[model samples]
Target: MTDHTPSSRSAARATRPVRTKALSALVHGICLSLLVGTVAPAWAQFKASPAVSPRIPGNRSLSTELKIEGMQATTDYILAVVNQEPITHTDVDKRVARITDTAPAGSRLPPPEELRQQVLDALIDEKVQISHAKTIGMDISDQELDASIENIAAQNQMTLEDLRNRMQSDGLDFQRYRNSLREQMLLQRLRDREVNSRIQITEDELTTFMKEDPAAQAEVALNVAHILIAVPEKATQVQVAALLSKAQAIQERAAQGANFAQLAKDNSADTKTKDQGGALGLRPASRLPELFVATTTKLKVGQVAPVVRSNAGFHIIKLIERENSAQATYTQQRARHILLRTSPQQPAREQIDRMNDIRKQIVGGQTSFAQMARQYSEDGSGARGGDLGWAAPGQFVPEFEKALTALQPGQISEPVVSRYGVHLIQLIERREVQLTEQQQREAARSVLRERRFEPTYEEWARELRAAAWIEMRDAP
Candidate 1:
């Protein structure tokens, strides 16, 4: 949903008099969760990390008289319990709106009871995960929270006061909304620690996946868009026939030049792509569903594949574009750095001071970059005169990359603090390289990681649910 322009939100509040209806409109209609794309691995999948959505159509409500049994309940109403943390009806409503918002604009909602149950379950799972984060002492600092809130407001093209005022008029508490944003960031960090860090593609596994299998080595990423005609898990012959006919009709319409995205949004049952007009994004063939890869591989760009059936549903796919993985160009840098990792004993300021001194020494000719790195640096590269042979784009984290990219071929960087430590980076040279044999294996490792990300994340989420103590309260 597009953000509420100040004028529009003001108009909404003025016409409604009280904020309840306007807030619901915000929750169910225009308001959105904070998410923009980060660099995802080249795989066609849902971009939004599926978290329980929290949308209370208007500003956070503190009203006493406006209580509607289940829907208008306050902070005290317990809808479910996860690890003894109370999940309120308001929480469930917000999440339900969030979930429904992700669905195609006109997609049919589940029965209310069913939708509520699903939202409750998702919230419980989320609560347990959040509880685990707290138990481990993972926290968002005030500075970090403030920055994230600012980012969210910027993304919505609003100032912080503008967002707060809009929420205020709708009866949504601005502070609680900020808390929600912080939790979203926390969940992301928790998953990066628990799920992403755990998905390791070992050298042996990568080698076998690439070299041992001739086919895997030649795998490519395809840009595929698909419209799904969903068939229920079980159906009679009559239901099957109806679905197949519907799928065929949609295919013929797309073949005849109807807007595929609009067609998919209006008709497709695949929730992930329904709103996207059926864009699956780019997916490595190896990671794609076997049926999808096989069917679409035979077609050229702009050609529609025949409707393919699986247990879930019928897929009508269009081949958008394809790229050869072998043709991937990689930028490589020969760099080195002197590191001073901050510890409880050595604070960040001390580390920065030390690196600044080291840089001064290098400039004064008292020591070379390599000599200083060996004597004062705290990394494995210190042994090699601070030479990082050749590194690729994603080989370093974003902080380090930003620092590295700012250096000239022979220049020294001011001390930069990354997660690993404080570093004074020096660039020796940079060059573009084709995928060498070694690089191919590394690329294959990335492919394996991409393949495993969704499934691994799903498994981790499932484990979180399974391990939690959940008690469902009777429906209000």
Candidate 2:
């Protein structure tokens, strides 16, 4: 097996989260501090340290941790050597065990080796993202990471201390749990940076696509607001009534012209978007609780509605924005770009120079933008000469689409930085986007891309594994 360990790989894998099922089990939602001093005595199970920890300068704990990890018995092989890393049978066994624990009691589980291989593949892909993140110098602060961890733990119905103790009882180490949280957080950051930040879903595209599927088009947008009081899933009748009354009072205040958004900010317990002034932006009406949609359509913009109760919490909703079922206006835009990729490992300047060089070439007419995009655009659409086919407003990354929409046909944009990379774009054509055959094809493609993220991410993991260095040893 080929070995590609960074000169630094000898330090043992402790500081890096194990990226296995055990780590996922302990701190699935909560943050790292939940694991403090919670490691149980080594059991028969294979143990890998969770990698989420505050980075100490030259810390050697991870190496020591893994030396101990190897002491456990290996039950099965997880994956074949990729590059050189042997994802062991024991690793697979742990992942399957963890999955069984999380699954409903009677669920069928994957065979030992099959589950192991899948988990190992995912782990390798995660490593690619982590490695990429490091290249771009993207690091999560321990404070924010910890806060995220705490939120996750609370959701799992456990206190930080209790969660740690449970992990110990399961023969898992708390540090490994923290490391997993850190890694997942890091992956989220990278995904946002790599994909979401750069993706543009245009209003025209949404309209055209939905038009092809009457069901999708039939969906109406709901402008919703709520005053939430969080109660346990099994709250008493008196407690539930008290919470509902509190919601009613908040609604009364809202009807009296108290700042509805500010009221939500102050009183809403739906922390997800409460701080956004209780804005659940333009959701499909069907997805709203039946009572909410029924009342929402009856109110005009800025009108407060009656209180609505749902399993999530109690709420008094107000209508802030609404879209009638009328079809949206769309404008087709053709654009071209030259792109340069940046990662945490590379200095920003390295790619900046490359983008600038590409920009200079276009300006100097050394090569057309389309030719350059075919050669260098890192995006999937690069194959189409960076033609984002047709976009209406809101279709491209806001920054990119904004630049494109501002240009007349044949106008070229200056280099713009988006999460994906730096891009130089041009507008080639402009036309109103209404439902058309061309639009339907693109719409179907868009639907597929959204559906494909998880599988795509998994496949990407496999590809990374195929190219990475991994080491495996026989069960000791």
Candidate 3:
């Protein structure tokens, strides 16, 4: 995903609500558990390493022979051993190279030695976790591993062959890459099994949590769209005036019932969201900028806010949707889908084409959506004509929720691919309803569980590390 950080040109560029890194990483085919401080390299969170010129040597693992795109081959030797598994110097080097290469622009780097130590520690943790997983008989089936690779390819909008070729071109060995993914999968499953099971929130604890953090109980989520008219840093007063006038005109058009999305597509200076009709998606008030939340808080759905000036530019804001816990109300969506799970025999593209054909039949009136769904959908809901029932926000995965949210009531979505499978979704309807006491408590519990997860996982990992047999070796 492109960094949403503001550029030197404008702070408005950074005004887009931040998405959770896990979801973003998943969408981009990076391992999700890596974002949550799992065994994988914490590249995004860690500082980069200084450049190093590696010397090629005879003693190297087959995996280390595949050098990263701009990095030279390095001598490989044992750096550490965990449960009889060797963590090599090349292993640490490759991770450091990746971190250096992909670290966000303008990020600082730690001393080379310090960064290497961090990478080595992460590798040791991974080896320990993988060993534990094997000891516990936790293994990824071949079919499951294949499915994961296929999902990654699909998420990247590539065929399996394309993904393979891309990896090869980037100096990555296909088998080694597969092995790495398998290890990540094992580590994630192990953490979920060992860590998630340990977290228990009682009813009284939930009540206390909600009472202490009332804002959590009465959270407000907003879906806001904006059209930005950027003013350059060195702009004269005349230039600023011109941009402000342009913003005001756009705001007027939006207020008078012009299509905000269309206006955004035509004129919004914010590149990241303009393509998506300027919507930043539904996010908590805390996630959005203070100025934006404050501006749109009082606006009814579909209402527009007046032109506002900021350091970045002039903005024309529109309220798309709002869910307020204070009002004890939230929007619920009733959607149905025709799902076709992908397999090695059935490629994602073929399944997608099949779904498209099904969509065509439904849209052409040759068959009803429900009829097609009942006849062909592979999901459990197929028997019920693909009905998913009424669901509130976050009831579905991120990709599914995004597709569902984009559809108007009674409108059918184009085939959407999620981790589950390809889906042909139709939004039946949406309603705003009051939250029941039971639902409120459940929500509180959910929040508390998430809050507790990181600390619990860290403690669990520390215990595992302490118990593992580890030995440090001299660098050759």
Candidate 4:
């Protein structure tokens, strides 16, 4: 059923109140999970690492009586459980409050009871995953939790303090917010460990996969660099003209053998790439900004273009290299493990020591990587023996990719650290995949795996929600 339009509520509120409600609800409606573009103030003040969960001071009630005085209990008192965990009606109500106006301005909000049920269901699903995380012993460290919260705040374009104040003004409790954030972090970690880690494409597989992907097949990676003279956002036509002229002179210097990197560092207005000699990296030609593609595609590697104009400013582009994509396929080992985050208080040394010991035990035949993962690894992969099935070259963090690349079949990598945390990786098995075959068997496998992943992930979520204990009472 279509959701309800919240205009009635807006109409009932005074103008200023409506504006505040709209602003808060509108922004929250668009609030993305942990990863997203731009920073918000919420990220700054609410940063909590995985290790930062100080257990609730003590078990407490999970419901609050609304003080509406004359209003009756218009909504049903729903109590549900995911596996052994209970989800109170209040939990559902809170989520509904955040999402009531989320549908486009005109849609009707679902009935309060119905919305509560949905929220309850979702919370249950989340709990299942959390439970699975525990079974596999996945953990979020203090540092990672803090960084994720900070990142969310930044994405929302709010400083940490500002986000906290905004939440307070909106009647949202800080700890509740932290709990919500932690759950999301856990879900993401679980997905990575369960599904994403297992997905992989070999060089040949990637080659074939690329050939089949209309988007990739239609495009090629172009290595390019540029020198730009920019007009300030508020610059006048005259000022713009002067900047363009300056660009022309700089281009001349570049053409006359001045080092492009040095010149870019000194003169380019494209700050993102200026220090790297205006290098835009190996980006798909089709996706390059129109002006960039138009100018650079026409020039051979090492050739500099005449002045080009784009939204940012005027630019001179140079093509460095181009890679034509071909058929893709992969055959590789898949393994999983949990992660343990490192922090100043629980430094890398501590995590390293712990993981190293696990590695030693596993190596000495005292324990399996899977057992060690479940017992100790901090990554969500711990649920499944640190199995990241078959991955393509660039799928993992560079450090992880490097370590994985160095392992032989059945070989377990020494404890390796990535931005996420320390990991104990094991090599399952490696297989050769030929995309040239008619069935493109391996490619077909990859496609099937991709298709199955979503539902499997949903099931995994269901599993986590089935196993967690959550309460929704407001803080005292």
The local lDDT score (0 to 100) that residue 167 gets in candidate 4 is 65
Q: Relative to the true structure, how large is the alpha-carbon lDDT of every model? A: 0.63, 0.53, 0.68, 0.52
- Give RMSD to native, each candidate: 14.7, 16.9, 11.8, 18.2
Instruction: Please list the residue runs of candidate 3 whose C-alpha ends up more than 4 Å from where it truly belongs after superposition.
Output: 1-44, 47-72, 220-282, 285-324
Give one digit per residue, the lDDT tens place, for model 2 in 137-214. 998777655544443443344545666677676566777666765765576556534553344657676667666765
| TM-score between model 1 and native | 0.56
Using lDDT as the measure, what is the rank order of every candidate, best first? 3, 1, 2, 4
- Model 2 off-target regions past 4 Å? 1-217, 286-298, 324-326, 330-336, 341-349, 352-390, 393-421, 424-476
Kindly give the stretch of ten consecutive residues in candidate 3 with the minimal lDDT sum.
55-64
**Ranked candidates (TM-score, high to low):** 3, 1, 4, 2
Q: 1 or 4: which has the higher TM-score? A: 1
Best by lDDT: 3
List residue ranges in candidate 4 displaced over 4 A: 1-216, 327-353, 356-390, 397-421, 424-476
Of candidates 2 and 1, the better by TM-score: 1
Stretches of candidate 1 off by over 4 Å are 1-32, 36-76, 105-112, 212-219, 225-283, 286-291, 300-302, 309-315, 327-433, 453-469
Q: Count the backbone clashes (under 3 Å) in each candidate.
A: 13, 36, 0, 72
Between prediction 1 and prediction 4, the one with superior lDDT is 1
Candidate 3 has a TM-score of 0.67
